[model samples]
Target: MTDLHFECTGARPEPFGASPTLLFGLRIEESDHQPVHAIALRCQIRIEPVRRQYEPEEVGMLGDLFGEPSRWSSTLKPMQFAHSSITVPGFTGTTDIDLPVPCTYDTEVASASYFRALSRGEIPLLFLFSGTVFTGRNGFRAEPIPWHKESSYLMPVDVWQQMIEEYFPNSGWLRLRKDCLESLRRYRSQRALSSWEQVFQELLATAGAKGGD
Candidate 1:
């Protein structure tokens, strides 16, 4: 595994399924490296229906695209793990990278609800989009978690844009924030998102954690 930097503001630990073993799901990467490939981001939000508990997803994107989503079964459980591609232009291959997540604390209720459950040990966290598991080339193609969205598994551009602003917003942060924002803006509808640029600036001022650069 590549050595990654992560941090947790309001995170702890919990248990997984079946075996119900304790698992930790907090932002673990704190680095200044730019993601090599994809312009998109993904996060693994831990949820527990039993106690109505959940955990905040990590907030950032890692390296570039390599291949397609390869589905495989967990050696211990029926739960499926989807391993995506991995490819960075000159970076050989990153053995370690964290998933990208947004500051849900200041945004929608889904995020709030998840955080609330996190403190209760009702769920365990995972980095679904980190280079540790999934990957992409040029840009990562996101599949919507059926549990997160009903229509398309791909994260709608607006949500992705907000996430970008939250984690890596500086011009030096990534060479493609402008492109990502522009793409999301193209998909913005009257009811979707109206102000990504403004949101980016606002989140930078508010979600003051010093990682995911």
Candidate 2:
């Protein structure tokens, strides 16, 4: 068995409230063991309040708008985990992890369209994966538990973009923005142009025939 180190970068933050957050980019390293397939390192979040009290106007407005379920306050809410995981293969060890959570406004919409309407940028949720060392057969295993801290605010996507640009200016951060747009465009194009599954099946058939030679 080969020893491999694994790291995950770009784990997004979960919405606790309007507080600023520090999102971490992961770096994993290991020796003497093969990396496990689909191992994820969960992130740790910590929140400290700068102000002591919630804004009266904000609270009032929430009560007026939500009618009763508005428990909006100054503290960050608990972090919510997504049903997703990161996959890696072969490993000696792994460390520092960041994984983005997919956003589906369906639940939010069903509960409160007002809350969903207030959304901007990407949602501040994270994907938590089981962290482990020891990949294939004949390898040693280390099971890791995920730890999460909650706050009372959501970090806007715009804030995250600005932070990225500031911290990693020379890293071609705009490329990531462009990539997100490009991916969305590609997905929309495929949906509009034809059946994606049919297209994929055709390509598979062509490849299989060629390989038969």
Per-structure clash totals for the candidates: 25, 28
lDDT per model, in order?
0.31, 0.42
Best by TM-score: 2
Question: Which segments of model 1 are wrong by more than 4 Å?
Answer: 1-94, 106-108, 117-122, 126-213
**Model 2 collision count:** 28
Cα distance off (Å), candidate 1, residue 130: 10
25-73, model 2: which lDDT tens digit per residue? 5565556434455454444332222222334443443443334433344
Q: Which residue window of length 10 is worst by lDDT in model 1?
A: 59-68
Model 2, C-alpha of 166: deviation from truth (Å): 24
**Residue 151 C-alpha lDDT in model 2:** 23
Number of clashing residue pairs, candidate 1? 25
Cα deviation in Å at residue 125, candidate 1? 3.2
> Model 1 over residues 45-136: C-alpha lDDT tens digits?
43222222223321111001101113112111112222223231323233233222323333223433323222323222223444332223
